[model samples]
Target: MIVGIDLGTTNSLVAVWRDEAPQLVPNVLGSVLTPSVVGLDDQGQVLVGQAARERLQTHPQLTAALFKRHMGSAQEIALGKRKFRPEELSALVLRSLKEDVERAFGEPVEEAVISVPAYFSDAQRKATRIAGELAGLKVEKLVNEPTAAALAYGVHQKDKETSFLVFDLGGGTFDVSILELFEGVMEVRASAGDNFLGGEDFDTALIQHFVSSQRQDKHFPDVNVPGMRNRLRCEAERVRHALGQQPTATFSLAQGGRQWELAISQDDLQHVSASLLERLRGPVERALRDARIRVADLNEVLLVGGTTRMPLIRKLATTLFGRFPAMHINPDEVVALGAAVQAALKQRAAALEEVVLTDVCPYTLGIETVEQFGRVLESGHYLPIIERNCVVPVSRVKTIQTLHDNQTHVLVKVFQGESRLVKDNIALGELSIPVPARPAGEVELDVRFTYDNNGILEAEVKVPASGEMHHLVIENNPGVLAPQEVRQRLAALAQLKVHPRDQMVNTTLVARLERLYQEHLGEVREMLGNMAGSFQQALASQDVECIAQMRESIAHRLDELERSPWQ
Candidate 1:
């Protein structure tokens, strides 16, 4: 079966179209939401989801989270003694979700439809597909998250004719999509967002507040330490969520027998997050302008992603549109459900025979060239072949002549973004096509860009005179892997020893104790060490009741010690 996966930054989920409707598939923990974290335990076994997240506090050096932000880059994150690319880390999460789907269906799942942020670049999209391959699944398609959400909403209201805005603010990325639905057809008019802006920025704001309040900047165990930062980030996440329902929440962190606490109000969160809120406005305005639809003309504004749960985000929407945005569907699950719907559509499911979906390229695709100004030839000009918001599965061509006589070859430098200058845009790839040398402005070559439904771009340069054609092949880009490298990486990932899911209860507690041991000193440190030893002995006995009792006793004691300061 082709399952749909939303490989998110903070959390991920899997869903399938069963019983003629989309249904979520729960993990071994019986929860559909899986924390997007990966780590290596003390046993040298890989840990994922909640288990890995717990280790982030206790074994920060061995755990990695938020790697999604580096998806299109060559940045390698260190987990203990080994380092891994973002795609590889994402592959581990996908593999875990793949297991969940198989367990739910009592069968193997080999193909999937994965969802990505609407504003993800071409290289990022390719990296996502490579991640799927590494996870032992065929990537059937890459659906834009907002487009998927709209498709899910459109399928339910098949006959409704309306134009709406999709405001998606997730853990690590933000996207604004404008769409129109009519007669069972959903069309994306425009898409815009900052790949770097998201809910995590709010967490950073909260972290800064606690840092300044506590004056921990000069502490012996500096707050900048990985373990300390993880502890603070975890507490900040809680306080941020709590402020959504209450006016005030306390941010607390414990280390070296001392507890630091700060009570913050919702107003404080808004004030600190003011700059981030402003970043949201530019994308919204740009999308609307590109779609040529006025805010008043929009039939509705649909909110998607878990970050939208914050009252502050919702309030911003209300102020911008003069009406509260619709949240009829669960923001976190909506995209996954939509992805499942897309998967079913790809299967040509009878229930979705009437539904037709379409999406647009989120950024402009062009090449760098020189423009003549009087007698001087100025370089670095960007000539767009395919403009942003153009419907996908699109092919656009532009013709240009040789810059100077005896120019035996034409170089095509491909780029993506809205910048008028090539220097300001993202370089995808480049190719040099040999041409018959001719006088200046005489040898014309045709450059064509074909953007497929999956958002992968292909560039071709053709010499009409000689009928010679060259295709752009991207190389040396750290984000993209060649066919041979992909095979090697796949084999490398297969050799990792993953910890069994059933052992997470024991493993998580041990990880927590290790974290506590490092945070304490004197008698407390020795006591925690002994307590961890006792729990290991209980596990070795293979007595269920004994292990349970020991686990409970240690857990309670740890909680008590964490809450109370010690001398």
Candidate 2:
């Protein structure tokens, strides 16, 4: 059965269309949300989800988190003795979710509709598809996260014609989309976002504040130590989550024979993360502007993603739109659920036969050209073919003549972004075609770019006189993996053994205890060690009830240790 997956930054989830509704699939931990983390255990088995996330605190050198931020780059996450590209790490998360869904459904999942941030570049989107391929799932479509959220909400509100703004702030990316639901069609009017702005930045800000505060007291923890930075990051995330529910949160850390404690209020968090909050405005304003609508024109503001759970973010969004945002669906699950809806739509499910969804290209697509201004000829100028926020499944063409006399060859360099200069934009690919030698400005080539609903681009350059044409499917670009490389990596990843699904809960518990053992000292360390030993013994006994009881006890004890003021 085909399912939908939200391959998120902080957490990932899967859902399927069942009994006329989308239902979330629970993982081995019996939770819908799985941490998007990957690591190597002492036995060199790949650990995913909570277990791997916990391992990040004790074995920083052997774990990777937040690799989503580097999806399309050359950056690699080094775990143990091996290095993995961002997509490889992402593939592990996808595989874990796929396994969960397979076990839950008692069937093999072959196809999926994966969601991505609306503003993700072409390279990032491609990486996501490759990741799915590596996980043995055919990615049928790459739905925009905000668009999926809108679809999930709009499907239930199909009776009304309404315009709404979707503000999606996730762990590693932010996206703003303006959508209008009229008749049976849900059309995304405009899309904008900051790929690097999200909840993680807020966590980083808090971590910095704690570090700086400790430095002032001369009890600074060496953040450069293997696991120290991750420890601080984990604590910072806890504080961020705590402040979401309460007025203040306290954080305590022990390192290098010194203990540090800090209390951060909600106000303090807002003040520290003010810049990130401000950054959110740019995308919102740009989306509204692009949609040719004012804030007052919007019927509602929809919030999506766990980051939007923060009161500070809610306040900022309310202040911007002068209205409270809607929280009808769980922000974390909305995208995945919407993806399921899209998957159903793809299959032409009877329940959604009348529902039609349309998306927009989040960035401009163009070609590099030379512009002549008086006596100066400026090369590397970007000429737009399809502007940003334009409706998808669109075909736009622009014609240009030869640059110089008897120019026998014309180069077509395709790019994406809204920039005046080509150098400032992302170059997709380039093709050089030979043309019959003609006088300057005599030979004109029709450059056409077609962007489909899935956000994939196809560029074609045709010369009518010579009946010559060059077409590019626009799959492999610089910085993105080629098809062969993706297949190679797929085979390599298939060989890496993932920790058995049945042992995930126990593994997660032990990883947490191990991390705590490394963080504490003296009595606390000894206590954690003993508890871990008992848990291991219980696991050896293979008594389901006793092992479960031990796990619960150990988890509660770890929670107590984490909350204790005395490190």
Candidate 3:
């Protein structure tokens, strides 16, 4: 069966349509959420999810997390002895989710609908598709995360005609989408976001505060060390979560034979994270402006993503919209659940036969042109063929005159972005048309861009005079993969080996102990080392009861270490 996957920044999850509703598929750990982390064990076996995440604290140099922020870039993450592209790591995560769902359903699943940030560029969207393909799943669709969340919410509210705003703040990306539901149609009016903003930034803020405070007290660890920085990030995340549930929280760090304790208050969190809160307003305002709707016009504001649980964020959203945001669904799982609903719709499920989903191009599609303004030749000017927020599966044509006398050809350089300057926008592709030589303004050509629902752009230049057309299916742009490259990468990724599923629990425990062992010194270090040795002996025995007891002892020792201060 086809499923929906949320390949998130901090956590990934899978969901499928079952019994007329979307149901989450638990991982081997019996948890719906899997930490989006990838690493390698000491034995050089690939590790994913909780196991990899635990290694982050002690083996930071051998682990990769939060690669989603670099989705469209050429950046490579160095994990253990291997180097991998962001999409490659993402492919591993998708493969893990695929394996989980298959094991849970006792069947082989081959297709899926994956969710992405609504504001992701064409290159980013294409990268996501390539990742899915590499994971051995046929990606039928790439649904915008906020749009998917709206669908998950709208499916239950079919009887009501309403307009709502979806504010999505995930681990590493934030997207704001305006949607309208009426007469069995769910339409996305506008979407905007900052790919670099999200829950991680809040963690960074707290980390910085602690660092600055500790530096003043002269007791901070050297954060330049990857392990130390990751440890602080872990503590920061804990503090961020604790502050969400209470007025204050304390985080302790052991560094250089000293224990440092920091108390963070809710007010301190708001103060340190104020700038991030402000960044949220820009996208919200832009989405509303593009939709031509005021805050009062919105029937509701829906919150999505785990970050929205922060009281300060909720308060800010309420203040901006003049209404409390709706939390009718679990913010973290809603996007994946909606992705399942979309998958069902793709299959033409009987329950959603009347539901129609329409999405818009989040940015304007245009071409660069050189125009003569009363004797001045202006270059780098953007002439929009299709405006932002225009419903997709759409085509727009704009006729332009040649810029110079006797111009033999016209060049159409396609771009996508909201900027008025072509240089400021993302270049998609270009095409040159052979035009009949004529005086400026006498030679005309039609430049058309067709943006499909899959977020792919196709550009065509038509010379009506000679009935000659030049067409280009925009692909292989910078940061995007060529078809050949995608195939090659898929083949390479398919051959990479993951740790055996049945041994994951034992592997994870060992990795955690290895990390904790490195974090301690003196007696504690020796204690952990002995425990590891004993656990190894028990594992070699292959006795179920012995292994279980050793596992419990190791867990208790680790817990005690976490609570103990450095000597």
Candidate 4:
């Protein structure tokens, strides 16, 4: 079965279209929300999801989270003794989700439709595809998260006609998309976003506040300790989530032989996060301006993503459009459901037979050229062949003459972005085509760019005079992994030992206990350590009922301890 995956920065989920509707697949833990974290246990076994997330507070050196923010970069994170790329970390999460799908369907699955941010550049998109390949899944399509949300929303309103704006602010990215729906057709008019802005940044803001406050009192925590930042981050998230529901929450951390707490209110969060809020405005305004639709003309505004659960974000949306946005769909699961819809559409499912979809290229794509200013020529100018937000499966062409006399060949450097200069844009690839060496303007070249719904771009250069043509699909992009590198990564991934699926419950419990143990001191720390030992001894007994009973008993105690307010 072809599954739909929302490989998000903070969490990931898998869904499939079945029985004329989309259904989320539950993981082994019987939960649809799987934390996007990966780690190595003390025994060097691979751990993912909740287990990995728990270890972030105890075995921070052996775990990695939030790698999604560095998707297309060359940076490598150390997970224990091994170093892994962001794509590699992402693949681990995908592999875990793949196993979840197989367990749910009782069959082997190999193909998937994955969702990504709308404004992801070519490098980021390519990196996402490579992550799928590394996870042993054939990526059928990379659907933009906002577009996928619209597709899922459109599935419910296929018979109606309307225009809407999708505001998607997730764990680590923000996207705004303007769309129109009519007669079972969903068209994305424009897409824009900041890949670096989201809920994670809010956590960082809280962290900074706590740190700055501590500094004023001449008290400093040894943040250089491997797990200190993780502890602070956990508190920050707790405070952020608490503030979402209540007017105030305390950010508390135990460090430097004392308990540090700062009471933060909703207004304080908004004040400290002002810059991020401003960043959100730019993308929304740009998308509206690109779509040429006014706020008054939009029939509805839809909010998608877990970050939108914050009242601050909702308030911002309300103030922007002068209307309360719609949230009929579950923000967290909407993208995965939409991906399942896309998967069904790919198979031409009968329920979606009348549905048609069109998406835009989220960024401008073109070739670098020289602009003539009277007798002087200035290079580095960007000539757009396909402007941003143009509907895809689109092809656009531009013609240009050579700049110098006897130019033997014209080098076409392709780029993507809205900057006027190529220097400010992202270089995708370059192609050199031979000319007849005719004087300056005598040689004319035709450049064509074709963008598809899946966000792949193809560039073709044709020398009409010499009948010479060259085509490029941008495989040499610096951000993409080489074929050999992919093979080597595959080999390396194969060598890692994955923790047995049947023992996940015990693994997760142990990780949780370890984290709790690290958070307390004296009597509480001793109690947690003793509890962990008892659980480990129960597992060693090899008695199913004994282990099950002990697990329930210890889990209850942990829950009680967790529910208590921090010191």
Q: Is candidate 2 or candidate 3 better by TM-score?
A: 2
Deviating ranges (above 4 Å) for candidate 4: 473-476
Please list the residue runs of candidate 3 whose C-alpha ends up more than 4 Å from where it truly belongs after superposition: 216-219, 473-476, 517-531, 552-567
Clashing pairs in 1: none
Report how far residue 452 has shifted in candidate 4, in Å.
Answer: 1.0
Model 3 C-alpha lDDT per residue in residues 322-380, reported as the tens digit of each score: 88999999999999999999999999988898889999988888999886789799899
488-552: candidate 1 lDDT, tens digit per residue = 99998999999997777788788779877765677988999999999999999999999989988
Give the alpha carbon lDDT tens digit for every residue of 301-382 in model 2.
Answer: 9999999999999999989999889999999999999999999999988989989988999999999999999989989999
Q: What lDDT does candidate 1 reach at residue 419?
A: 90
Of candidate 3, the 10-residue stretch with the lowest lDDT total is 558-567
Candidate 1: residue 335 lDDT (0-100): 94
The candidate with the higher lDDT, 1 or 3, is 1
**Ten contiguous residues minimizing lDDT sum, candidate 2:** 472-481
- C-alpha lDDT values of all predictions: 0.90, 0.90, 0.88, 0.91
